[model samples]
Target: MPDYKAPLRDMRFLIDHVFDFHGHYAGLGATDASPDMVGAILEEGAKFCENVLSPLNRSGDEEGCHFDNGVVTTPKGFKEAFAQYVEGGWHGVAADPAYGGQGLPSSLGLVLSEMIGSSNTSWGMYPGLTHGAMSAIHAHGSQAQKDTYLTKLTAGQWTGTMCLTEAHCGTDLGIIKTRAVPQANGSYALTGSKIFISAGEHDMSENIIHLVLAKLPDAPAGTKGISLFIVPKFLPESGERNGVSCGSIEHKMGIKASATCVLNFDGAEGYLIGEANKGLNCMFTMMNHARLGTGMQGLCNGEASFQGAVKYANDRLQMRSLTGPKAPDKAADPIIVHPDVRRMLLTMKAFNEGNRALAYFTAQLLDTAHLSADPDQRQEAEDLLAFLTPICKAFMTETGLEVTNHGMQVFGGHGFIREWGMEQLVRDCRIAPIYEGTNGIQALDLLGRKVLGSQGKLLRGFTKIVHKFCAANAEHPQLKVQVAKLNQLNQQWGELTAKVGMAAMKNPDEVGAAALDYLMYSGYIILGYLWLRMALVAQAQIDNGSGDPDYARGKLATCEFYFKRLLPRTATHRAAVEAGSECLMSLPAELFAL
Candidate 1:
């Protein structure tokens, strides 16, 4: 396996230039994240990820987690590394200062997360789920709940997990069998089984705080009956063991170091977090956070794989250059000289950098949504976040899977072998699209719920921003052509929505039929707009003679590659969207496999 190096230069380019993160932080009144402070954090974060976390990635995967009796133990060094993370305050960089956190901007935490994820995805999962659990409690938990759980969670004395899935249900929370009964005391007794619970019973934290969903006896039917609860492994005040216990931990394809356990809450004492019969609504608070973090996994694994593949491409000798001898001293030229190899490498590059741009841009909105005082600003940010979140989760993972495959292919036969560590990237990324509501479900949420449900209002929020950018840069000397192309797509995006809206009106199934394709199409356009924005910045830097010239030009070249090569994928998805449901529904269910 090749050593992982944090792409600090590129990360800085996005933070300092493309997104203007410094200005964003100041606007949010996060003066604590001064430019110098942000720089120091990123540098120190890189060292921790590189020296501490990265080394454990492969070894952790190989060792996996151990399940004994009812206790879940993480692989070697995971516990110590997590302790170091907490001691260094890395665990609560974005949590509220009231809860013993550093009180940094949320976006800054995401910036740090990219490195943590890229270096050791399995290890990152421990804190990753905890952050999601914290968000839910912060948004919906009672003041008492916050004082008790958030303080420990923020201080890293305890970790958290979101338990929504049961063996009988995944996305359909409506039919969950978990039950919560009220007690004479203010608490309830939760008796149910939750499966696929990451960090559910890990030994890395002193206590595991579980945010679980169940129903009261008199509650309404379906999803409306659900209620959220905080069930801990150990009673907070008395320090006695609760009824919650690990039934078993799953043996999975990848991320084996992270404990994915089946948790049985056997009359566990639980406290309600939010309004009764509104558990799904409360869970969304955590689910949305988890979805975004899951989307980052695509970028994380793709980056790790890309680093390995690119290194191998440069060092591994293969066929000679077609036209000439680029490296005559060697018996054969490096594989990177081949056009086919370049194609795979460029594809990986275009998707990784463009996806990074999209992720960072979304992080800015996250900050505005959370930190801004203005109701109108917060609402706009929220609207945009709702629209972009599904796309970010679906599109990025789909392309991320593609990127990792290409990375493996770049290594030829060596890629298939486990020693090179390229194949593990594929296995690790495989679950991303399937989990977090699956890419299919994410697509339905995007095209069906968010786009059509809003009557196109949500779609317009994002397109309006793209329209404004294109209008401002319509006549840029270096990027006018690219800007014009993005402008045309911006308009077409609205037209496509209107077309789908019309079809969905006539046949509701049209939304379901066209959803995945529509989402992929939307994703390409979104990436195109982001790539143009990045190119605009890079070109301006070149003209002004600021920053590294090669780096600036490299951005310009990647932007051009995206426009010419990958943007064409939109055409296929567009065609699929326009095809409607007739062809799909026309086939009878019984005829399949016949």
Candidate 2:
């Protein structure tokens, strides 16, 4: 296995050049966070992830988690490793300062997340869930709620879980049957069974907070009546727990050390998160954050798999090259000498780098949207961020699975075996596209809510930014052609958006059927644009001699690969989107036999 190393140089290039993160941080009122400070923080975070958490990854997968009745235990060494993780103060890197948090810019925290996730995704889930829960509480919780749970969650003394899915209802919140009854003491009695709850029941923390979605007795029907509640395992006076318990833990395909539990809230004590019957709104706060993190998981796993494949390709001696002996003294040439091997490696590199840029760019936009002094600038940032979120989650995860599979293919038979850790990467990444609202759901949100509902305003705003980048860099010989390609794609996207919007008005199923492919097509164009921007940034840095020449050269090479090889997929996605709903919904119910 390759030694995990954080791509700090690449991260810095994105932050400093592509996003101008320092300026954004200052805009966010993070006056203390200079470039040097950010670099130092990233370095420490990288060291912690590489040295403390990464080594546990293989062992965690191999050992998995153990469940005994109602108690769930993580793999060996995870407890100590998690303690180290919390001790490093990483749990609150981007959390609010008012609640034992460092209040760092989310852009910096995003880079740290990639590193930690690349190092050990399974272990990463423990803190990952905590952050999501913390965000929900901070955004919607009352002052007392914040004072009680926020600080403890930030400190990593207690873990958190989001309980939205039941066995019957995953994406359709309207079908959820969990009931929350008002109690005499201002708390509610929650009784329901929730499944697929990550970090729901774990021994790592003294208490586990569950942000559950249920319904009130008098609530109207469907999603309009849903509500959010905070139920804790033990009743906490100060920072203690409430009466929440884990019914059992789930046995999953990968991420073995992360406890996925079946939680049973049997008359459990609970408090409302925000206004009654507005749980879906409050839950979206957490879901959106989790969606981004899940995307990072995909990016991180893809990078990890790529790193392993690269090492294996460079070190493993195989048949000699067709041209000549690249290593005449050795038994055979390295596998990297083969074009097919290079193809797989380059493909993985292209998607990993592209997704990295997209994730960081989105995070930067999030920070700007939150902290910009001008309301107009903030609204613009928010709009673009909303438009990109679904792409970040759906497109990135979809490609992440593809890249991981490519990495596994590079390993041949060894990839399938559990010993080399390639198979686990595939399994772990598979869930990202499925969970977090599923890629299908994300697609619907992108088209139905973001594009069609917003009347293409947000999409147009984003394309304008791309156009401006292209116009400013028109002199760059290498990137000029790629920028032109993006311009063409942007035009097509606009036309397609109009067509889909018009068609959907007549036939709603058309939107449902084409939504997924449209989201993917848009994502490809957006990521392709991002890759070009990153390459341009790297080229500028190289000319200025500010960073390593090899790093810049690598960036340029990956950008080339993305344009030449990966960008072509937009054509197929466009075709699929244009196919409309006929093929999908053409079949009648009686066509199938019982």
Candidate 3:
């Protein structure tokens, strides 16, 4: 099998050395949280994933999800695996403490999420969607709703899903045909058919709470008219009948074990989540969280792929070295001795470590936004979080797919086979860029709404943080070059932001065409910052002689590889973004017609 070990030491290095998790949590009044406690929790989470979940990954993928007679059956071991997961209290890691959660920092939650996703992504989706649904309800639901659902969801007794897409509409919600009618009891009668609903139906939970998006009879046309509703599989009170039922589940390309259902809601009993005719706004609250989670899935899969490739490289002996056969006693030499193979391995290592640092920093910003005492600090945190969300989701996943692909390449023929598991990593990581709003959509949101729409204020604020870090660490020998390179990239991104913003004013299509490129550029610069931060931390550890020299040396070497090899991609993206909208728009609608 696959030997999957949690990188707990590296995780601690990022938390304590790079981002200062203890100071962050202490500032938030979470004085009870000690490094020992965090370490124990992560160890337990690692064991749960390795011992309980990882063993089921291949079986779940081969069996996939099954649907018959309007009931969905998960892959054989899934139900039992999920049951064990809940019993371990893994579900409440980041939930509110008042509702039976451990209320751990989101930073810790990020590590757990990465572990679970790496172990089995399809299995990760069930609770992942549940967390997103719970976030939506917690933000907009009434006291009664919270009392009824929050505890159950936090405890994993009940699961949740967001039912947004229909057969006709996936990204554009303006044309959705799902309908809702106000009832006499203040609830609504919802009627719609939703497709691509993950975790829609399963035997793992007692009930499934669906947060549905639909339109009212007299509601305004397009997106503004949309409304969100809480429609459960069974009634909340008596566990009686509800109008919602599963028609079937989709047979997908990957993440096969996670049930994707086609749900039919015929006059389903429903209650409004927030104000009527404002569902899109409420759904975004959940979508933002879901999008981030999807990004984490990408990072997690990349990490898994790297581990698998490294193991294979160390064990798989093939060609002899060009200079001499170091293992003349053996059949051949290890593939890792090849320079090209080493390049691929180094690429995976650098991207995975950089992405991990990025994810953790984003998680820290999220915590600070909610927990920081100063209003100015909170606002700054929120702005940075909002600005980085798209980067984290789009850039991380895009690079993640690249890293996994390289990992597969390192495995040679074995990587292509399903039995070896590397192929599954590629297939599973592919979806992160497509779902949770395609990377293209994420780019548009970043350029049109977050970056240029605000006249580049948010982007500027973010760069200022990088500038401060660079200034503070100017004397650090290892980080100086990387910091300078990042500064140059940031300057170029700022200029590109202005040029694109001005061109977008002439025609909105310009924004649509260049959004993906801009997102990639931004992602590279942000990762550069993460590399610099990690390098600084590793240098400190080495100077103080506080940890193993090899580990610290490995960290510095990865940072060097990132700066030398991967950071150059920013130039290509900058050029693409600067090419303007003509390349994409020049293709006429009739060009493809025969």
* Per-model RMSD to reference: 0.8, 1.6, 1.3
Q: Give the TM-score of each candidate.
A: 0.99, 0.97, 0.98
Error of 3 at 593 (Å): 4.7
At residue 179, candidate 2 shows an lDDT of 96
Weakest ten-residue segment in model 3 by summed lDDT: 473-482
Which has the greatest TM-score? 1
- Candidate 1's C-alpha runs over 4 A off are none
Candidate 3 local lDDT, 1-594, one digit each (tens): 366788888888888788888888988877656778787888899999888888888889899988889888899989998888898888988888888888887777778988999899999999999999988988899899999999999999999999999999899999999999999999899998999999999889999999999999999999999999999999988889699999998878889999989999999999999999999999998998998899998788898899999989988999899989968889999999988988999988888888888889899988887677889999999898889898889988998999889988988888888889888888889999999899998999998999988889999998888888877876666577777777777777788888988888898888988899889888878888888878777788899998888998998898888888888988888888778888887889899695
The better-scoring model by TM-score among 2 and 3 is 3
TM-score leaderboard ranking:
1, 3, 2
**Alpha-carbon shift of residue 95 in model 2 (angstroms):** 1.8
lDDT of 2 by residue, 1-594 (tens): 446899877787778878888887876787867888898888899899889888899888888888888888899889898798888888888888899888877777778889989999989988888888998999899999999999999999888889999999899899899999999989999988999999888779888888999999998899999999999887777555455667787778878888888888888889999999999999999999999999898899999999999999998899999999999999999999999999999999888888998998899888887667889989998898889998899999999999999989998989888788888899889999998899999999999999999999989999888888778876677788888888888888899999999999999998898899899899889888888888887788788897778988998998888888888998998899889888877788788664
Lowest lDDT block of 10, candidate 2:
237-246
Q: Which residues of candidate 3, in runs, are more than 4 Å off? A: none
After superposition of all CA atoms, the RMSD between model 1 and the true structure is: 0.8
Every candidate's lDDT: 0.92, 0.88, 0.88
- Please write out the lDDT profile of model 1 over residues 19-81, one tens digit for every residue: 999999888888899999899999999999999999999999899999999988999999999
